[model samples]
Target: MLTIIPDLPDHIFGLRASGEVTKDDLQQVLLPGLEKLSEQYKEIYYLLVLETDVRNFTAGAWVQDLIAGIKHLTEWKKMAIVTDQKAVEKFTDIFSYLSPGEAKGYKLTELPIAIGWLSHKA
Candidate 1:
């Protein structure tokens, strides 16, 4: 399941992912928020918290994610992925350089700090 974490700073877009995520979850729960934020802001700060190891993503969801990232390439301001999973952390570290703004990974215990970092101006 993918859950939206509300009440973040106006420019921060937050999501908590648990269990398995499907294309429907991305389409139904996540896309609308991104669309709304895009309308209001030129750039977006993103916080993705992996509450549990993702069981897996459906093939369609993987494609959707790629499409969204490409479509919003320049709109990303900063991105923080909070997860205890080592592979996830490394994945973020490896690809972070591709971001126009800062990108980092944090342990789950550091979620508060991640939120602060995302909300802060760079």
Candidate 2:
């Protein structure tokens, strides 16, 4: 399941995921939400909190993720992935170099720090 992260500032687009997140979640919930958020904020400050493992996502979901990412390629500002897995964290950190904007991963314990970092303007 995917749901919006509440109580965030206008500049941030945040979501929390648990269990199995499917393509429908992205096509229906995630993509439209980003489109709306991006209309108001040129740069997308994304925060995704994963309560379940990344392996839980279906194959179609991964495709939709890529599509959603590419749809807003130039508008990315900061992406903070909140997951407990160290490998995922390291991957996000390394991939940040190839991305137009910053990307980082944090443990659930560092969620507050992640949000704070994204909240600040560069």
Candidate 3:
């Protein structure tokens, strides 16, 4: 499931994911939430925390994520992905190079630092 990460500034959009995050979660929760935030701001800071229990994404969910990302390609101002999973870390690292804004991956133990980094303005 996905839930907002609380206590962030207005321009920051954060979410914590655990368990099996399905296409419905992206459609019903994440994408719509980002869409709404996009309407409210020109640029958005994003924080995604994939807790250790998170399972693999469904095929459709991956497609949705790609679509949403392309739709808001320039909307991201900063992004931090917190996880200990190697594949996820590698993917985030690669995606970072293609992002318009700064993107970084942090170890699960560095979640606090990741939040702090995203919270700061570039």
Q: Which pairs clash inside model 2? A: none
The regions of model 3 sitting more than 4 angstroms off are 52-55
Q: Cα-based RMSD of the predictions, in order?
A: 1.2, 0.8, 1.6
lDDT of 1 at 20: 89
Model 1 vs. true fold: TM: 0.93
Candidate 2, residue 52: lDDT: 86
User: Tens-digit lDDT track for model 2 on 1-122?
Assistant: 89998998788889999999999988888898889978988778999998888998889899999998998999998999999988889999998999999999999999999999999966
Model 2 residue 108 distance off true place after TM-score fit, in angstroms: 0.3
TM-score of each: 0.93, 0.96, 0.90
Candidates 1 and 2 compared by lDDT, better number? 2
Model 3, range 23-118, lDDT digits (tens) per residue?
A: 998999889778888999877788999984445678887889889888999888888889988788778888888889888888989988988898
lDDT of each: 0.85, 0.90, 0.84
How would you encode candidate 1's per-residue C-alpha lDDT over 7-122 as one tens digit per residue?
89988889998888889988987788778777898777888998777557778878888877887888887889999998888888877887776788999999999999998866
Count of clashes, each model: 0, 0, 0
Q: Which segments of candidate 2 are over 4 A away from where they belong?
A: none
